[model samples]
Target: MELQKTSNGHHDLSPDRIPENGSPVTRFDALENITEGDTFLPNKSNGKIETQFTDFVGKTSFGMSIFNLSNAILGSGILGLAYAMANTGIILFVLLLTSMAILSAYSIHLLLKSAGVVGIRAYEQLGNRAFGRPGKILAASIITLNNIGAMSSYLFIVKIELPHIIQGLLPDNSDYWFVDGRYLIIIISVLVILPLALMKRLGYLGYTSGFSLSCMVFFLISVIYKKFVTECPEEHSYNKTVPTESIYNSTDGMCEAKLITINPQTAFTIPIIAFAFVCHPEVLPIYTELKNPSKKRMQKVANISILTMFVMYLVTAIFGYLTFYGNVKSELLEMYSKKDTLMLCVRLAVLIAVTLTVPVVLFPIRRAVLQLLFPDKPFHWVRHISIAVCLLFLVNLLVIFVPNIRDIFGFIGATSAPSLIFILPGIFYICIVPEEQEPLKSRPKIQAIAFVTLGFIFMIMSITFIIIEWVTGKKTSGGH
Candidate 1:
């Protein structure tokens, strides 16, 4: 791989070929190569298909694409969703979630439309083609920030939940450093995450990843089951530290939570929902992998993935919120006693899922950073290991210093997730399908403008809201 300098004196990250795969680079073509709106009428004569743009072939089926994409969309963020609901009450949370889901779907539409027009599928390449180096750099930077923040959240869960598991199983709980949360995070990172993170490809880690997904399901079931079966002890072990009971009222054998409330913390729902639907970076890769790639096929995959994740998130959140109500913590698992038999299974599964996920999330951040810093260089083992070590160290420091995962979610959700999910897609659509040639009443133009305007508002408000949150000392959650 060589960094090709464009005619206009800029570094082109979209290389023509990759020696490792002995094939053309993924999605490095210009939009002029394909006819507009004609989504992949592949030439399949005999058993062979023709792709003149590059020798690379896609073997992933449409259904498989949906599974892959849904896995991407559902990660550690689900843990904090109840926290989000608790922050913005049930009513406002639902409204924000619906709007964000719609925006996410439409953003994907714009991205696919633009990429389809140009036959480009890489996220950074799309930016380069639409705008230039600045655009490409910006795209890469946002990916790094959003992905790193996401990975941090995943590890932060490990930091919080793993300690509970360890203490529960351990015969010794007398302030040993081994059982401590801070040291345990580093130890887990070394013993478990490091090896998994070192895996060659995302496909190699599939079984563990799938198992982790199963754990999240168990977590949902545990919440729903425990809500009815288990009654809270008069004194929760951490009751003194976590004073959340006072926030809710018991009325008619149910917790009384408001449907809507507009406090400083309510604004956090924006970033939380924004981060929830953020799998945009993975969209292009999955699009390229579809057996007979087409924007329509990819759109189907995206829709299925989005709907599946939305259902999963909605049920998990509703159950978790209903169970904990006023006592809901940032991470839902923290709300439960470590000794509960049902929740222990949920804990082990989720802990496995989240710890395994650290590596999965780290892959994109490393890739994005490499694209930003070293586009010309091919994969080097030394560089890969070094980068992974550095990233894990940085994440460890963050997890230790930053006790709450929700804060990381809020910050990253506000800053980078919006740009990738909303703004860039709208901008790319405007560039590819120019309004200058379209009629004044063109629906696409109107929709694109509206999308951009909505994106701008989301971005601005998220930042402003977070700033206000920091100033008021209600940085992580609504309560404290």
Candidate 2:
């Protein structure tokens, strides 16, 4: 037994006594008996520790993890993807999105490879392995700011979309606060999200994950219907669908159709797409709960989730963009006329999907906060509830102030998301898992170094461009 210090004071943190039943996360043996020069894992025969999520151990399956991770990856950020496509244009939008998805998958590979190399699974722990305490804090902070920005995006969707849906359903309503976005978000947090957040284990959330993804699929189907089947008003409706050739042949309505246009506004695509694919923070926890956690098995889970989300993103963006063409709004559904029954149905479905996802996003944010504040503390109801309330309050506060999702997604995606997706993973992989003794001369290390350097450049350019757009008062268009 080792006495782990907590706000409540020193408590026994026995190596084999994890709350997650039937788990073999006995690595705490190293923590309990750590010597000055002890390797993070003692007597390592192989570079792996089979992880079971500390609270939900042995209860999640490979398929369950995939659905949950897919839910995490495909967030309200998808709402703005049509906007991204509009800005980047059709050809470039598809290319950029595809590239970002590939890079995101590669980054996850690096993260998992590094985890296997060092016998660690947690994102913060990977940082600790690479650069000690500061690295851990850095990782925690990135995840914190990134998630807060993301949570705010979710609530931002709720704030903007829910009111529109309610008003659309009852157009004659004259009540102000009755349909106010801030109050509606408060209601949602208290009712829908609070119960899910309060749950002690992640395994139970899987059932909800299925429902959540289904809602998004319904939303996707609705978009396709509105584009091809749902009758559009004369102003918003197209006589014919925009063909691939017109995009290939022209550049007006086919804006951003060029291989790559160098507009500052479209540069925001890096973050939006980055934000769309950011389930990295949740991957390890999901991996821990995987039925037979291994680098190969977990990597497979990651691939399937990413690939599935890529398809969803591509389909949703194309159909939504085709429906509105150059006029696609940041929130795709917002682009549709309010009275259309099919559009209303689409809006309602999306509202439900994003609403259910709030707690899923909250789970990792709470975990990161707890790990940072009370690394060794047992999960206490008081602490858990307090943190959950604080996150809800804090995120909602940001949501209230932030004008829209694009700015939120653009800012966080440019600054924090690149680090989470590209820079940090690259640095951690190079530092922790040196594939060659002279990693300085090693091909893998060189590639990682290039990747991190590119990530920084990408982040810097994105922020600079977004700021320029703000200064110039230029509006961004949407895409792929």
Q: Which candidate number has the best TM-score? A: 2
TM, every model: 0.80, 0.82
Best by lDDT: 2
Worst 10 residues of 1 by lDDT: 238-247
How many residue pairs clash (N, CA or C atoms closer than 3 angstroms) in each of the candidate models, in the order given?
A: 1, 12
User: Residue 292 of model 2: what lDDT?
Assistant: 56
lDDT (tens digit, per residue) of candidate 2 on 62-129: 77888888888888778888767766667787887788888888899888877665444578777776
**Per-residue lDDT of candidate 1, residues 131-211 (tens digit):** 767877888788877777777777776776777777777757848777777888888899998998786544455566566
**Residue 297 of model 2: what lDDT?**
83
lDDT values, one for every candidate: 0.68, 0.71
